[model samples]
Target: MNKSLAASVSPALYSSKTNTKIFTLTSAEHNIEVGNWKIDSTQLGILDTYFIIEQKILHGGKQEGSKIITLTSPNGLTITLSPTRGMSIINVIGQDMRFGWDSPVKEIVNPAFINLESRSGAGWLEGFNEMMVRCGFEWAGHPGLENGEMRTLHGKIGNTPASEVEIEINETAPYEIKIRGLIKESTFKKAELQTLAELSYTPGTHHFTIHDSLTNHADYPRDYQIMYHSNFSKPLLEKDAQFVAPIKEISPFNDYAQKGLSDWSAYLGPTKDFDEMVFNIVPFSKTDGSTIAALHNKDGSKGAAIEFNVKELPYLTLWKNTDTEKQGYVTGIEPGTNYAYAASIEREQGRIRQVKPGKTVHFKIKYSALMNKEAVNKVKKEITDIQGNQKTTIIQKPIAKE
Candidate 1:
């Protein structure tokens, strides 16, 4: 929001010498970095902590905008910390899509939104009206889970002292950043960075990859709903927009959409204030095809597509919140690690991935844009070299299903 960069745009970050693990800022834009920190079973003990490089952007300035990025813990396995940029809150004033941290979702037994808690057990979110944020990035269009479900990290694991991580910046690499820390009780190490780049006349786009590993040390089974809560502006999606995925049914939220409850969960609409929603999507069915899915408009113009290593996360969720009176803007495309308390009533019944101590399991998902038919034809030709050797991907669509 602040156009002036001289003072507000200088290098910035949150850091501490004590055993700290996370860093946050909200100056020019919102950014959050999950650093390495010490953890002790003794309860609030030593934690090998990490911090952000100080020279990025000053946080906590007079201006409040939007949260630029958020790096949640890979092991704690809960969506607890989300740094909103300017202002955000839950819709307590109007409609609450039936949410409670203790247990979430209405018709199903699983949770959709991430349930975050502060290190001090402080209530989630800085305020009420603006509650629960991924403290990360919003998507180009509405999220996939909006079709019927939504999700985020929901809980915290491990023990340690000092809730926030400290930071100090360096001038080297210009574009590269660094951090260090370790969660005491966590099974995996933490790595995350948040930085900004000033584009030139061309108006460049942000391109990067998210890398992490999941290791389960617990003796019992460990299931993770691994994913990114791709956010979007509902207003931008509009009424004429449409969604497509690999699955056959939608909205298990509807009491009678499928063959009995088994095949029943599917529906259609600009479902609510958030826009439209599609649930229980299938996978990209072919190598040249996709059981996952893509979205489009009434005319079959430019939209988006989602496909990943099905083993990484088999299901994709399209979520939206139309309660404009309650929440300002909410739309999401969530590729799920597990069914939304859908398909099955018991969480244990799902494919809860388990890792033996000293062993690690890993997975990754790619979220990109969707272009129109003209654009696709351009890229397809480029791929075979009929065109120039540009490697940029055109948003492709999966073949449609009945």
Candidate 2:
């Protein structure tokens, strides 16, 4: 057999026409060549997976100075990470199912992706939505800084950019790929904090997982806040879509949501100048300490689900916006340690968390999608079985937006 053609054949099987006995080498440690034939371990069918990673710089726009790294899987999963923007997953595509929202801004590569520049003292709302945006290490709300500096919409971490980015691919059995990045948030004479985020995925499965560790390297104890802000839009979040979560109780952020309390899980069509609603979901986790939240179309054609550890992220926030096209209609599934209130409010509410110097905290979350009825049922049953038919109360409060 020709050397090139024999390389593709199963080494365990003999080609009678070749008049030679075959021996399969399962290990990739050997480089045996005989009579111009080379035995390649990768072609032994040990694993079926492939991945590609690319780093590129943007140009011709405000984001021109920005940079991004993209990781794609052979099984139809593509993720774009902004190392210059808190290492956030700006875009996600998988199995004909898209989970991220379409923001009013068209790009995530620049500071212009952020909406408002000046602060009006209202809850910070100038954020640019991405597939997954990290919220904080110091404060994640709209109140002014401790030194009286007006706070930006979201925290500064999302705009801080990563320092050391690493990518690894292993073609071993149960093939996997991982991307790790380090981001730091510091002040002039204050404490410094760092977050190391690792995102991993396996081909042939519509799932991805995140593992993060935040460390407070300051000499004294410091307060910290963090959240995983994941958004969904369009086809999966269409009119009549349903939301399922293991909620123990829910609190509406304003009167608009109060009036729509009965249909908190119901989605409506976009309207002109529509008011956005925010709901705080107190979820119940399974015995393993994990909770689940999901959304699916009315006809169950497409959907997405998320699982997180309640111990790490006890608070879940649901953001619903059905405004006009220009304003952008979207929904967000947020899990964090604190609510999306002013830093002062969170402090007063005793929801802010503190980390001992030299101590590290870990957070993990998993994401999967449903492309058909079978996948939908599996997610529904999992959530139902995790939390029984427990009814909870909804508190109503009002918030303002300019």
RMSD of each: 15.2, 10.6
- lDDT per residue as tens, model 2, 157-217: 7877665555444446565666666677777567688887778877567888988888888
Candidate 1 lDDT trough over 10 residues, lowest sum: 197-206
TM-score of each: 0.45, 0.83
lDDT of 2 at 354: 91
lDDT of 1 by residue, 65-138 (tens): 21222222222111112223211112111011111121121111011122333333222222322222222211
TM-score of 2: 0.83
Q: lDDT of all the models against the reference?
A: 0.30, 0.72
**Clashing residue pairs for model 2:** 254-397
